[model samples]
Target: MRFKSIVLVSHVTDLSGPSEAVENYLKTRSDRLGVIYHPFHYCADRRSRMQDYRGGTLLREARQGGWNLPALATYVKDALFTLFYFLRLGGRYDVYLGADPLNTVVGVVLKWLGLTNFVIFYTIDWMPERFSNKLLNAVYHWLDRFCVRHCDAAWNISPRIQDVRRSQGLPDAKNVLVPVGVDLEKIDLPDKSASEPRDLVLLGALAPSKGVDLVIDAFPRLKERFPQLRLHVIGKTPHDAVEDGVVYQPYEPRLAALGEGVILHGAKPHDEVLAMLPAYDVALALYKPSPNNLSQWADPSRVKDYLACGLPTIITPVPEIHKDIAALNAGIVVDYAVEPLADAIGRMLADPGQWRSMREAALAYMRSYSWSSILDRVFEESFRAKA
Candidate 1:
């Protein structure tokens, strides 16, 4: 059976990993899919830069603290555009899928305004509690409740987030857990490649929540045992500080000074990052527990990425990873503490035979999480049946 049409609305465009994954999934299965994405503000091309009409007003408001007039104006304009887009394609679509709270809100409002039919709200992470103050949190909580109650179905990246929605009293709640899946075909590993001298490689955004500091602290101890061991950190620094007086900056110089083997390669495109995965001995995922960490409560996307690359992982014992590690025997888990983390990395690196075995085990485990399998389930359970 074919969908009449599927409408996707998200803040991120096709350029982002999450958006690209979802878009690719829908495009592969259906010809009647259309997308309405928020303007891309970070594109370098001049023509593409003009596509984001929201930035001008936001920049002006950054100079002065109160209500951001320009940002509000941009949001209003986008909402209007969404309304027009919804009406244009409303009759042809069987379902509307939105990623994130803002997009969900827009979809719900458009539906309420008689612009569309079935609405599916996809939750990548928990919102309000993660990013809002007390008053805004209350408002967002009510908004989430409203969306969950009104939408035909809810799609969450993890079961943990589904629990959060269920607790909020959503009725007939169809919580579909759709964790990001691995594209096995894209992640090709070299069979007889020489391993880098590095003991651990941490990949993903270089934010505090990702626990870059923990890895840095752990590196010194790991280096003591294997003097030639190196730690390579790959990802972009945050543009602004999440905490007070703690500005985000590149960790290269600071980390390099602490040891001889710490190298920060900054952020590269997703394909480039995946290409380097095979060269490393182990993939380290040391995210600290935080409000912003919806993935910490659920399954992290990077764990699948690491496994797809056939690399043994050393991750903190987050609930999701803990369960997977035990079931799959894919990698090692340790406490988030520095001493244990260092010990875990050292243990994996010290034994080549064990490391090789774990690598094969990780690949075997990752086979079940290919995008085709996961997306097929998501389509059947979340969208097709529900609609």
Candidate 2:
């Protein structure tokens, strides 16, 4: 019944939704666990430099650095760091788990080095086909497939991803769909009187594919109806003002030009973000649908968090979220187009009774998706399975 240790490797230590899920599982469960994070070095540096605006500056810096390091240098750097880290700590763990493709590559190498008893690749996104460069994308695919082939088991966050792996010829028994879970006990419906203005809230990384710009574009039309409406954007910003030697633009000014309704809150602490959730009338998951491999296959963590808070969700009709909304009848799923989103928000605001009904259903659905419940099964079944 006891594991010697469970090691989790991921890209960053920041309070990302996926990292929070892993932390929740480790802290609440009885298992012995340790985490090793590979934070983006330049982003971390910019955060230390910029006193007031860390997130935005860091993101800009990351973009400027480009997605990949110069080939020979990256391989050498990753190899050395991976070797040193595993040599120091890997032997103590009975099971090693990696949270993304990058970490999975490292985990597979560590296993080859005989550093751990077993290795599990836990993927939250499919990255190979999502990268911009065809050549690099091919390389990423090869590494991803190599990792999957060598790993003992794979943990996927959505069935869409499991299907992708299977389609790529991976064995069915090697992968399990473990959608991200939320802390239902920590979230509850606050009194409506406590709600702020009928503002829309969007939370997550402000990257290109997140579709924040689309929401900004749609706001003017929305304002024609609800002039008092507000939009609160909460998450980390870019790392620098210059990306790839070009001046990086801030989203604030552009979004503000649409109207005075936009507010940029930057990144808040986990509890603070959750506390602020109930203050808003509706939660938005406005990411654009892309055939880009990652976007098409991944399940967004914010969707679960928004639903767990019992807030009515306005999200795009992405396959995974669409399926959840259809099954639970918990939230509204609209097309990625701004018109549909604007109209949906307007209708929900106009009909208080239906909005309340959706809110209750969302809360009910969240109860069954508690992190405690999900991790108990994950521990007993996946992590504990013999190699």
Candidate 3:
């Protein structure tokens, strides 16, 4: 895996989103000279800087508007800034691993400028429909297609996205399936908090599109069935705005005639969240399909976190993510409807043997998704190409 240099780039500098994967990937090759371009702070609630690209430099921008910009404007600015920084700061390298579409677009520009030998596009999720306005969606679609056309190789996270790119005229040879990876060391994590087992948990942003309401709705019925069932909601939110059974829904209507037994632990450190995964029976990741979820191959990192902890996941049909879970029988896949979700919960709770098997299967699946192997393959494929 020798090279002149290898760099990874992303639009966001926070440790929360795709940058988390970049950090974990760097851990596998700490000795290598790897640069990372992540200039802006996207998380205001926490000041979590991404891990420095040790043995190399971190290219950053001088201008940033922080996290308060309008959604469409934010992405537009991100793409523009990524191009600006990469053009100015990117040095000669063998590969520039892009952690997002916009950054991959920058990689394309870098390749055209001869700053890098190869541009590898690494994306966990994408869909043009994410933008609400028609014109904005058109701009996103055009920029994404530009990325698809120019990158030397693509590390697509979802099989569904592979299909999407194929339909959009990407050749089969240009794309490879590279699912998200987890730190294998997180498998048997020591507890950071002495918390009792929560029967159910959802640990991510509690935004409307995340399907938080469905989990809260399922809780009342789930508690009735299991008696000791309690739902743990952990992640970022707008305010201290949650009650036991009565949850807030700013984007959609509240789940009426739903259940209770909700406990809001709010947000915790990333390490703390992973540490607390062992104290939960099931990890809930209910991302509703289509418009609710903006990804063609929806990235459910929360699902990966659950599997890394050996917890059986209960997920909605989240595109390719659901298929992976269902194929391995790693967990249950239920409809977003409260009744079906509640039924799945009851089924898991009623059958301990099945639960154990699913937990085992989840661990087995994790064994195959090591970041070390994934990164090696990414580098190998990127450099060993015909170009």
- Candidate 2 global lDDT: 0.67
Tell me each candidate's TM-score: 0.81, 0.83, 0.81
User: How do the candidates rank by lDDT, highest first?
Assistant: 2, 1, 3
Model 1: weakest 10-residue lDDT segment is: 46-55
What's the count of clashing pairs in each model shown?
0, 15, 2
C-alpha root-mean-square deviation, each candidate: 6.1, 6.3, 5.3
Model 2, span 1-387: residue lDDT tens: 345466676655245667656655564342445555554543433111101112112112111222345543554455455445554442456677777766777777766777677888888777445556677677777877887788788888888778877887777667677878886666656776333337788887665566677787777888888888888888755664432234556676776677587888887777777777766778888766666625557777778888777678987776477667756767788887778888888887777777777777887877778777776776566654543
Residue pair clashes in candidate 1: none
Instruction: For model 1, give the RMSD to the true fold.
Output: 6.1
Q: What is the lDDT of residue 321 in candidate 3?
A: 69
What is the TM-score ranking, best to worst?
2, 1, 3
Q: Is candidate 1 or candidate 2 better by TM-score?
A: 2
Which regions of candidate 3 are displaced past 4 Å?
Answer: 12-15, 27-52, 56-64, 83-92, 189-198, 238-261
**Where is the poorest 10-residue window by lDDT in model 2?**
46-55
